[model samples]
Target: MADPTSLLPQPNREEDPETPSNNLHHSLDQIIEQSEASFGWNQFLQSILVSLASLFDGTQTFISVYTDATPTWHCTSGTTTCNSSSDICDLSTSDWAWDSISSKTIISDWNLQCSSSFITGLPASSYFMGGVIGGLLLGTLADSSLGRKRLLVISCITMSVAAFATIFSTNVWIYSALRFVSGIGRSCISTCVLVLLMERVGRKWRPRVGIMQFFFFTLGFLSLPAIAYINRANSWRALYLCTSIPAMLYCFLLQFFVKESPRWLFMNGRGEEAIAILKKSALSNPNSEFNSVLLSADLLSQVPESTKSIDPYKSMKDLFAKKWAMKRTLIVMVLGFGIGMVYYGMPLGVGNLGFNIYLSVMFNALLEIPSYPLTLIILEKWSRKLSVLWFCLVSGICGVVCAVVGDKQKVIRIVLELASFFCSRTAWNLISMFTVELFPTCVRNSATSLLRQSYILSAVFSSMLVSVGSSNGFLSYGVFGVAIFVSGFFVAFLPDTRGGTLCDTMDEQERKESMILG
Candidate 1:
């Protein structure tokens, strides 16, 4: 095969060494491509370590499904006024009792069974609201200041600490407040971990490694049913303690093992650290002669002017300053909002499925397993636009069917709901990778986190929908179906980024776009 570096974008070193020419501008993608950074065993190991954060993020986000669930109730003996069909809100408190201890769920402990939907959904809404703020507030920091690895570790710790504190919550108000804090912390983990992992590897391994993050997230989601089942009789506090302690310890692993994204380092004018990471990656690859190439090329000197004026807030500005970037960001944000409604809302609304909640959640989580690998396969053949559009359309149809079927066909209803969630998961997974490819590295973290905020912003409403859906299927599934179906069409406007090299700076990406347009 031809030498890999021979095909990469090369800087014009023949120009005056003192005054670098515009020809000297190069993206980190070009540098890594030119360096022939191999996807070696160490790189694979680092990818796993970084992606593991998603596992905990997934667990923390969904654990509330069990901890906040309204426990089943039964009529007490000799209760002439109450029967199985009687609404608990209409019955006397003494006439019916919870199936499990009050401590098993916050709903029972806080006496929220008869409360309004807004009150019952507050904690979850609080969590997603916190995520929206966190993503907008912390998103630019990763791209401009903290870099990816530090922000990832800090986010993990913030979430764990907030979770640990949740065990002490005395009322629904306290619990909701802490959940909001946890949501803020949890917001940055997936975005930072993903950008960090994608930047660490070469283009050949990017898609495969990117998909690995979601696999870990599925594992986290799957773990919930088993953990909740095991702690069925214990206090809801145990759930918080169980997930938080290990996550806190995981931060240490992240701190010691994970390396910052070299692309972020170079883009922000930290040339030495950027070179060190690149050289380390080169050494890891047995086939690489990248170190010698690095020495000869002096790519760092070609760093763009955008990096020299690195302001943490400027990263956020870049997203809206360009008409193309703003339009692309808004379209994807809308797509994420719809997918988020279904992706998150379904699991939270599983109690309304008329099937056993644990079994329903298990099926939903299990369905996510196939979607990632299927996404991998689909992206290999389909454009990101088509893959997301079609999968979301299928999910929307199934969700509408689930709403229409209702309680009459319990089996079919559950099956269709699971299918909807599966397709939504596929679309959700694809759009994330889609967003990553949509923006340059200069604003990639901000863009990814912004997309997540759109998801979280939708999720804020999803919690209330789930509360209402517990009594009305149309409120939850029907709304989710319509939202996603309408939003899926927006994908047609987004430029397909599959198989394209990642751009390191705004100028580099803008130049590429102009060339294609001109």
Candidate 2:
């Protein structure tokens, strides 16, 4: 067993004395880390319960792929100007019609096949735009006031309500508006959930648990194809209804099964509550020999007065207040933007793959399964910086090749597209886990949310590109390749965080930095 006193800071006799609050926080960090070393059934249950949110997020996000797709059309029996090769926009409305009922998809229901790219892309763009708004406005609450569990429940419920209400939309405008609202709610689910899961586990288990969260996301994404295919003959509203109901029920499950992150509690000055939860977790694990004496009320009382108060908006302000945090934030966001462009864009743009949309999307979604384990290995065995850089490079190369090969070489184009998407997804998983490790818990969610927002912001443009690329391939695939490739180089500026201790405060982070420099 490690010496408890040695885990804490010593008295400073130098010019700059280390504050009592800092030492207390350092002791708490060490205590928490030690207690979390053994993963038990209790932690496993908690990890799974928290990860399910990603399932719904993935479901609602890609449901748009099928719900908004323009169904295949054919000419009416005797139409003079309409034929198999005819552009639907060039023919009279009466001369040609969609194979599926018009109500099956938004494109056919709203007669958007002939609409401008901007109009066709508006709903998806609005949804991503709402994510931007939600991330900026609501994300900070997790770190500062509401705490991780409450914010997660709120975000999930909000998303579910918005998604359920979308079934009532009467026009494309209303539909887009509801999607925007859903985006706001969804913007924080993955971020909060990811942070909460990481904080709950030990450093040894953190990467694996984080990857498990993505596994649920993959499960949610995989369900979309089967759900959409089953509801292909039904109205698009059926898909929303199916996805929303389960998500609302999931909110209830979260309430009953989930616990607030202990790290967030400690940071927000609820040391007693944090200790209780940690004790409970340690008790649940048979291998853990946690010392009950280490978590006394006296330890809680020693927490600095400055750390005891909750400032609801201070988290975001703190990000900009520090120069290192600011520079780190900008670099990661730029990297996130490029990965986001390809991450969300490829699934939505599966329509342009010159194959059946269902099969095309399934192929892409199926590829994501292997990427998670592969990413886990890469993170475990290699440097985060190198994994990110190479994944981006390979994804970009495949994307550009897909564009250059064109649709005529159908098999080659599809294979390259899948390869590109696969690599991008791997990079996406890496950067997300990487971002969490980069920032201290003090502003972790805020930093992650900002990264997510950057991705969503880029997705807004990706929506437009996908719409335009339905007719022009270079805009989507070619641009996606170039963007990610250029962005990958930025990883060189970031420090490798493979085995660093997770910091709980900005002060702690600064101390670690100073140690490394001197």
Candidate 3:
């Protein structure tokens, strides 16, 4: 009988030093490239299922803005009792008459507007805070025991439950906590889905499929305004019910239909399972002849020696273990955080831009329509680094234009802000795919989540900035412009990953200490 170890493919040092056994990413890529599954229907179905999480996320994002809307009010008699313009200390039912007594939010219903803006903003902020905490807790699970499919399933369920229970939120405290939990679950869903989708397909097609997946997210974003517009005057609960129900259905759909990532299965020493998946993918295509060699179990287990023994938590620790890796992470996060300000904050501030909140959100969402197809094309035609750089440059310039224009120029302000958001959305799409291409699969979740945490962290401040600048464009748009512009230079410092293969470990991605530097 042949020895099991002897059958393992030995790595040739000279020809391909970076390619290793547990680098199941490339192994899966090789398998797909050699088989008909590279662009097969099975993979297409899988991509569609996986990208649903983004749609869930996009809906959750702007729902709060419309749901938590402040009710319009009027002074009953041109009156004597009201003391100040925005009463910071006192707001009573007697002091104002809601324009529509039937339509209201917790803030208006409870008369919490007189409370500090900090208090009014707490629920939204809690959502971002929970996302930060959740990233620390569940982000690494994608790389280890749970894997991407399980983590995404559990996370989506959590989000759906939280969102559904929000229907019962009787007061501010209960509502805030639920939003926090939803944020926690939504962040987990966002992190895992991208990693799962990217791992499921071949490296060559990764850009095309992954960038285009956000189209579903755009659809989700567009849907919210219509949902809200119809019910904005009736009940905010309607918005929650709509988003939560679809997300609930989504969890079941993913759990039953989706398969565990083949790369993840291979990485965990489930060789037979991974090979079986590859064979299934191969046989799923009707146009091509079957190839048995593509499903070789011997090839699936050829990862680096370190990956076999590396602790999953160590993947998180490794981000800062080396000076270069830490530097790479910080730079990426800074870029993400800088642009993340706009990516995460734009929807929140859309109402501030003097447009109807519903139309503004839908208009902002409209930009994503063009951004998606252009991004898909740009990703294929350009360097990942240059794509980010150009996106930043355009977004930053438009943002500054938004700041320079006057309030009297409402059309100009609207156009400039839209253009800025368009570029920011483009940058956002590139950056999302860039993280996958930039890091190894082992720490891919940790790396992307860390950068995302930075985005959330920046969002914490972006929320504050939005509050401080809601009435003033310069404070928000100018800051976003400057940060994005400088981050573009930081983006240039990172490696260009266009047409590069995915690696399993940082050592493989960098290959040398100097590959990334301070």
Which model scores highest in lDDT?
Answer: 2
**Candidate 2 C-alpha lDDT tens digits along 193-277:** 8999998977788899899878899899999999998988899999999999999999999988899988888777776777778
Tens digits of per-residue lDDT for model 3 on 165-213?
Answer: 9989888899999999988987776667777877766666777777646
Alpha-carbon shift of residue 119 in model 2 (angstroms) = 1.3
TM-score, prediction 2 = 0.94
lDDT of each: 0.84, 0.85, 0.75
Cα misplacement distance, residue 128 of candidate 2 (Å): 0.6
- Give one digit per residue, the lDDT tens place, for model 1 in 28-68: 55567544356766677788899889999989999989998
User: Which candidate order results from sorting by TM-score in descending order?
Assistant: 2, 1, 3
lDDT for 413 (candidate 1):
87
Worst 10-residue lDDT window for candidate 1 reads 15-24
Regarding TM-score, does 2 or 3 come out ahead? 2
Runs in model 2 deviating more than 4 A are: 1-22, 304-311
Best by TM-score: 2
Record all residue pairs in model 1 with backbone atoms less than 3 Å apart, i.e. clashing. Answer: none
At residue 251, candidate 2 shows an lDDT of 96
